[model samples]
Target: MSELFENYLACWNETDPTARRALIERHWSEDATYVDPLADVRGHEALDATIGAVQAQFPGFVFTPAGPVDAHHRQARFTWGLGPAGAEPLIVGFDVVVTGTDGRIETVLGFLDRGPG
Candidate 1:
């Protein structure tokens, strides 16, 4: 289900509303909640706005997986890097995601590891 996690990152980078929603439907549970240092939101629509806000704040940047996804027992933890395309990351963070029985994300807890200093 690591590929499912990859598509979650893609949802962050996606600018098209329709495609983003579709990805959410495929990857996240209907009641999923996302919590980070900046915000906490529940459900797909809220996740979409949170992601859209991040994308807007970092216009032209892309989010990339920082390393291999380490997953087991329906849960996964991974790091992600965000920055201008092809450049070193300006922001890096880790997130732990848990999936529901249906194989879709149920919760995401995020941490801010590094950023402009």
Candidate 2:
């Protein structure tokens, strides 16, 4: 699970579009469903659009994991960040649930802790 998470972060950090897309193709299942704060996408095609949308909104983003990386029941949770250094991360302690078997991610659900002021 840690390996997968590590690979995910690495792929995300990669600047090249081809490389990132390849990583996504390799790790994500064909029918994978990706759920985030704003979008719920299914399949690689949809996932591609979802990624584009996210990148459009948060360019040069990365996930800053906080605490342990647990993959029990095919799910994992960690923190994520957007923007450059010294900027307060838009989200903290974000939860990501990846649904799949044998480490092949079939679905991902993300949750952000952003409460009212």
What's the TM-score of every candidate structure? 0.95, 0.77
lDDT of 2 by residue, 1-117 (tens): 777677666655655677777877888888888777778888877766666666666676655555577667778766555544466666554657575676767867777675222
Q: Candidate 1: where is the Cα deviation over 4 Å? A: none
- CA-only RMSD, every prediction: 1.0, 2.8
- Indicate the residue-level lDDT of 24 in model 1: 89
lDDT tens digits, residue span 1-117, model 1: 678668779888898888998998888998899999999999999998888888888899998989889999989999999998999999999999999888889999999899866
- Candidate 2 Cα errors over 4 Å, as ranges: 85-88, 115-117
Cα displacement (Å) at residue 8, model 1: 1.3
Alpha-carbon lDDT, every model = 0.89, 0.67
Best by lDDT: 1
